[model samples]
Target: MSYNFKTIRPVMPAKDMINVILSKTQRKTPTVVHPGYDISRIRGFYMRKVKFTQETIHEKIDAILQDFPKLDDIHPFYADLINVLYDKDHYKLALGHVHACRNVIDNIAKDYCRLLKYGDSLYRCKMLKRAALGRMCTTLKKLTSSLNYLDEVRKHLSRMPAINPFERTLLVTGFPNVGKSSFVNNITNANLDVQPYPFTTQNLYVGHTDYNFVRWQVIDTPGVLDHSLSERNPIEMQAITALAHLKACIMFFLDISETCSYSIDQQIALFKDLKPLFKNKPLLLVMTKIDIKKFEQLDPIDQQKLQDVIQSENVFYSQLSNKSGEGIAQVKEKACGLLNEWRQNLKPEQLTGGNPNLLREESILQGVYIAQPKRVNQNRMPVIPQVIGKLNRPTLKDVQEQNGGAGVFSFPLQEHFLLENPDWKYDAVPEIMDGKNIGDFVDADILQRLEELEKEEEMMDQAEIEDPEEDAREEMLLNTRDQINKKREMIKEEHHMKMKQQVKLHRPNLEDAKEDFAKKGIDTTFLEQRAQKFAAKKVLQKQKRQQQSSDDSDDNDMDIEGNDRNQRKGRDALSRSRSRLREISRSRSRGNKKVLTAQEQAMERMSKKIQRRRRNEAKAGDGDTKIDCKMPKHLFTGKSGIGKQSRR
Candidate 1:
């Protein structure tokens, strides 16, 4: 439950904070801007500065806010202690102001950046940037008082001692100068200032000591005066806070000798006044400076008064003198023992922060369970030795150090052997004898046990041979299983063959079709007759097409020869009529004898037009060999850096 407040970062004044943030922004962002550059670029330049400034301011403020502990989130002891030293309201307000300033800075940056996008000129953007930063700085300046207060609190908190409120604690408190600090200095290494003046220990001091191998925290609080809670000073309130909140044993120190400027009656009255705060807590009435004045030396009335308080309060009473160190150990033991007993008696709900729901949760109760025997027996009790003490023999570590340290001294391993004969502890036996391991015969009854096992195996074999009915039944079941397996395999093979036939595409020949139809017991005569007619009809159509094609080819050859002669004659003539020239050109222009239909000719013309258009635009085709720009200006012209080799 204790927190290390020393790790909280130091808070800076508003002026220093502004200077640091501004300088950081200047260093991190671009420093130059020009009107000649693109307007977008100019706007971006100033926008970056404003945004960076805002972010730096937010980071600094946020760090301060997070570093300080929230009073409500900590233990009540520390929460009240902080409230006593620094007013709770002021602490919260200071942190709140810092938080609010961060939000304002963020808003300023957001608004200015939006306006910068519309900035028409570089000067306008620069002004908006300046305005944003100035507004943020002004907001921070307003927090000067809060910041200063936080800075002072941070310094004081860093010096405060870390006290764990949940641990076994012994809280020492009473009027000042009653040997409370003296008792702590004697028991622990607290080394507190023990002057003979009241209120010498002005703040809470913590020290640690161990009992039963468990660490215990001892806290020395400033003395509390017998007055109303409202009238108590900050110093006294610290002690009161510890007394009110911590689950520890309260050790009320009383100076019965009257050397601390408080009478027995007054000290007892103060104890009674603070008794309400000790409800359900372990209380110890420690009488210090007993060397000066023993309890029995007091007046009979004073003794009776002390006895009465002890009885009424139900508290433990003890006396100690720091000067002579009398009863100091006894006091520590009694306080620690009482605190431990109180902690043990606490309920499950009390241990889990008083949350009853947590008790029902399996995770919380995972380690807590009652282990009970199914049936209790008298012999189940654990055995305990009559005498338990350290052995007289030296340990291995002690013997090793005495000889020549670890490496030079080696302990005999055989000395620890538990044998029937002590003198035979160092006797050695051969690992193997006559090709057989000596360990195999180490047991004296090994041969007899092996003979018994062999006889048992022989009897088991004879018993199996005697069961004729069981053997016959097993044979019959195995034969039935074999028949069932064969039938399952045959069914699987047939299913696979059917699946393959369904997926394959096959055009069976006439012989194959005849054989397949015969297997299916269907008539094949009609199918054969229809197939003969189909073949005869196909032959007649093929012959007709061949005869037609031959006639057309013969006529085409005669026309081509006549056209060639005309073309030769026209070439020989010096000049020919336009009609004669046109006929010759048309005959020679026909490359294929088979003529295209009207629609086909139109489609060809459209395709040619499309090709021409593509050629004009220099479009690449699938087969065209294209080489990319080898020296693109943007990529190759500038210095090669990361991500500059490719435009993508």
Candidate 2:
């Protein structure tokens, strides 16, 4: 896994965090509490304040805990680097304090909130709230030192170079001023200080360069001294940590000219000391400062010593001069090539732990077959035409240049059209000639076909005219069929009428009854006399009803006149008394008004002004219709306990 420590959030100091949490709680929760409020409401108000503050603190501390990389859960290279830069125990202790403080704040809030539930008065609840906030702040204040340390660590970590431990890396290390930094600057963009002193690069510096289309990370570690691990400082341990943990191509730099203040034997001894860390890793012994002193110019003994070191260590050796930039490219190429070869030769199980899914196999070779032809003595060669060698064709681009060139030159499209007659390619036929459509006559056989159709239609007409008897028989059959259809329709309508729940009965008038009786030759005088008697009876009854209604209306009018006269007298007396009272109560005003003091008059004027403004702006008043959420989702949904409803 790769890690980018630059994204760790900045840790805030303890005092600042406490103030921020308290201020946030004050701003988010209710601050006002009245003694008149119910004890439950007062307790809940304080409880919410305490809980909110604890949650705020928890969230902040949790962010720090989560953002910082855990040592036990990260890559060994980064873990060791972090341990070297910042003591492992100290870092773990600082984060542990933060985590513990977060729990303490939660417990304090919980205890205070439980006590708040029993508070009977607003004063008691308010005191509990204060106590809760104070205890949380005190718990946080105890971690001031840890918070400051973490904050400093965060700042340093954010500035640390982002290195991918799992990527192809080339680690450059050796004694101080041995041209390691200069070599890194030459190949990559690390650009370290090339001072002629030791420990110029105190921290691990990462730079990236691409080789064979794959990106490679080059880490320039601080110079290490010729001492045991216990005697090494943090600056030197950084290089040791990288060399011991990183699976990279180790380029151990050696100052061939002894210009770095370290002798050749000392550099070789340092390499031998670090040889255990280079197990199974590709190593390159890069001899820097060739311009100052060449290996050939060294004494025979020194050359023999270097050769023995190279052979004994089983490492590839090369020479380069940073000042002259001689052999720098070769050193880089050789390092990358060696690293790639080592990676390619690694066993599948070593990289993937024998996981079948991750095993590398030649999948492209599956189901592939190669066929070999039988050997023959005869010789076979490809034949070529003689004219092919002499053909020099002018391409489209050449033709375009010879013409007017690109946009101005248009190819002759008609020249490429395949037609039966080449000359017909450019021929144009008009759609209309004179007053006739040329398309209509495009087919030479159209007129003959039309004539044949006309002849067929004439023959069909003659055949029809010769068969009059058949036409008459068909007409008779159609009339008979229409009669049968009409009868069927009548029967269907009768059936529908019978199915109705209430059928309308046809009642004949007196005249129709008289006509029917006269046609049947029956005596109609008695029936006519009975009909006239019935009509006379109905007319007499209607007249009697009209006369009774007129009589009743006249009686009601008389009663109403009597009642109205009495009401008029009473209203006159009441009006006189009301006028007298109004005159006695009114103060010299145009209309009836209530007498008011100065304050009352001012209040009335203000109310009128406010009413007028409200009317103009169309604002809602106290009596306006409103819709409030009767049951809030957060309170109504999910599980609830005895006191959870009020808390939610």
Best by TM-score: 2
Candidate 1 lDDT by residue in tens digits, 1-648: 468998988888889988888888888888877789999999989988998888888788888988999988888788888898999999999899888888888998999999999999988988888889889889999999999999999999999999876666899999988988888888888899988889999999998888976677899999988888899999999999999998889999998899988899999989999998999999999999999999999999999999999998888999999999999999999999898678767765564454445444423434555588776755666675645335456789999999999899999899899999899988775667675676776898889999999999999898776578988999999999999999999999999887754566687889999997678566678779989999999999999899879866775667777777757876766356766777677875567674665665776899898799569757686466565777778866746678655210
Q: Which TM-score value belongs to model 1?
A: 0.55
In order, the Cα lDDT scores of the candidates are: 0.85, 0.84
Provide the lowest-lDDT 10-residue window in model 2.
Answer: 358-367
Q: For all candidates, what are the clash counts?
A: 0, 0
TM-score of each: 0.55, 0.56
Identify the runs in model 1 with alpha carbons over 4 angstroms from their true place. 348-648
- Leading candidate by lDDT: 1
Task: Please give the distance, in angstroms, between residue 215's alpha carbon in candidate 2 and its true position after superposition.
Answer: 1.0
